[model samples]
Target: MVVLTKRELEQIALPAVQLAAPPLALVPEVDLSAVEASDAARSAAARAVAKACEDHGFFKVTGHGVPAPLLARLDAAAAAFFALPQRDKDKAAAGAGGGSPPFGYASKRIGDNGDLGWVEYLLLGVTAAGAAAAPVALSEGAESSCFRDVLDEHIAAVRRMTCTVLELMAQGLGLDDEGVFSRLVLDRDSDSLLRVNHYPARPEAAGEPAEVRRRLTGFGEHTDPQIISVLRSNDAAGLEMSLRDGTWVSVPSDTRSFFVNVGDALQVLTNGRFRSVRHRVVVSSARPRVSVIFFGGPPPRQRLAPLPGLVDREGGRRRYRDFTWREYKTSAYRTKLADNRLCYFETTATS
Candidate 1:
């Protein structure tokens, strides 16, 4: 129900660089073929990576070892999945009203009022069942069986990397590594949505109004509220991140490297020590953009708020009240997204 008034938000130009440049570290590509030879090298790389995660909400990871051929297969499979006829694709579509989690496809307008997100998607969850069966499910009913296997492998690889990133983020925030990992990591019923988006080339404009052009976006502007997100895309780059000063930056894809960004959940959990940023993907008339986004959330039952340890020590004011992830999800479903400020505050607690 809460939507921000147009006056509340400025419709500004996208920036050439992310408004807030993430602490970026370039990780060299590690050949998976020479795993044994690179053991010590990989461990050192991991430590360096952990440091970067602690310092910046975003980073570029390379050399951990995923192949370019595998990346190509994922790209092809994603394209193939979206290429299916509407009727066939509809089988996996979110029900009439949409809003269900994982294991389904969503239409362009699914995010309410036909917001026209840049692409369609297949949701993924981290439940025990999903973990055990996602590979089989995605592979079995698809038009191509091989694609599913490849996609599964990719997901598994990314999940491992995500864990490493999250763990490092926790350590960087000075939290007990195990506790942070146990608390913030996605769990059963926690949705790890994978949006496979394909932006079709819009028809050439015949002197259309520029305002109309703005509406023809692959994805609109907004910040992810999840703790972490991992993105992979082909050569067609349309993704942009807004910096704190409101400059936008292009995050291009390098071989074997996927773009990782922080989300709101981490910001709240770490009491603003980390950050989630505003971003969008624009579609083009000449060529379409394809991207895969994995939005990772905690299990529904988990409580989310600023960690007490991170609160201001003077008078011990807690900026955010404790709320359950399930409740937040419900609130999101009921509200007009992006219309309101994301921060929430509670009465200061005196202990």
Candidate 2:
């Protein structure tokens, strides 16, 4: 966590804009059970996932096969870890040192570029080998050992669920191969990461509208740069996602289910067929919000561009230039969290 001085705090505070409330209807949802059922059932589910991706670029997921007790254990473990003193928590992720943009613990600050938030997070890299080895500081103690165990189980289950969702996405897109999307994420060198975020409770005081004009941003709006992201959060209502129309809507939190959103890579791969949702979190009430998100990215060396199948078919034209995940990732790291990192890669023509 980056410590803030008085001058820094002023810069970190921003007014939360009050946007229009979305329709009463919640985001569309997909159930994973059908994928394991009859062929007809699978088709129906696949169409639903496809439609949600094309229309909203986001959806809620159910029947994901992860046990509620397991998630509860995860929450308990996370809470225990965060409740520790700052010094102890710092020692936990101190292994790789900071500013790698790869993994470890962070608080208040979002990235190296000074984007601050009312959030603290633990980010761990996972590959074919296993969940990231528990940091040395965390593994030394009995309690931390249990945290590591719960963390391992949680990552294993989430990874499987995420891959299944990706497969369904392929089916929905009418792709000939279901594994096309899933295989990249499962590669031995995949840069997939799991982030456990805790938003501390900050009660909003009732006061003159002018006095409350400024709101603390729990997290600023930004699009996930990976192919997809799977997110689960406790029953805290701090999440807000932007709609196609540019209006922001509050996403009601449900601890039992997960939320899925498209990322920039998917947008490019689909040649603009799907959109990457921009989202943020705000500290609204006295309750705190804890969210766990898994970002599934391809290997750093994997080249990214609109799939030839999409571009060459139906007179489609390439909208983006080819680049490796490493190139894009490096570019994204240099910018602010809210910058449209994809814009630079877009192709344009002159008469």
Q: lDDT tens string, model 1, 18-59?
A: 333333233323232332456575455445544544454566
lDDT assessment of candidate 1 = 0.58
- What lDDT does model 2 reach? 0.81
Superposed model 1: Cα runs more than 4 Å off: 1-56, 94-103, 129-142, 205-215, 312-315, 345-351
The 0-to-1 C-alpha lDDT of every candidate, in the order given, reads 0.58, 0.81
Prediction 2 TM-score vs. true: 0.91
Cα RMSD (Å) per model? 6.8, 2.9
Q: Give the deviation of candidate 2 from the true structure as CA RMSD.
A: 2.9
Query: In angstroms, how far off is 340's CA in candidate 2?
Result: 0.5
Model 2 steric clash pairs: none
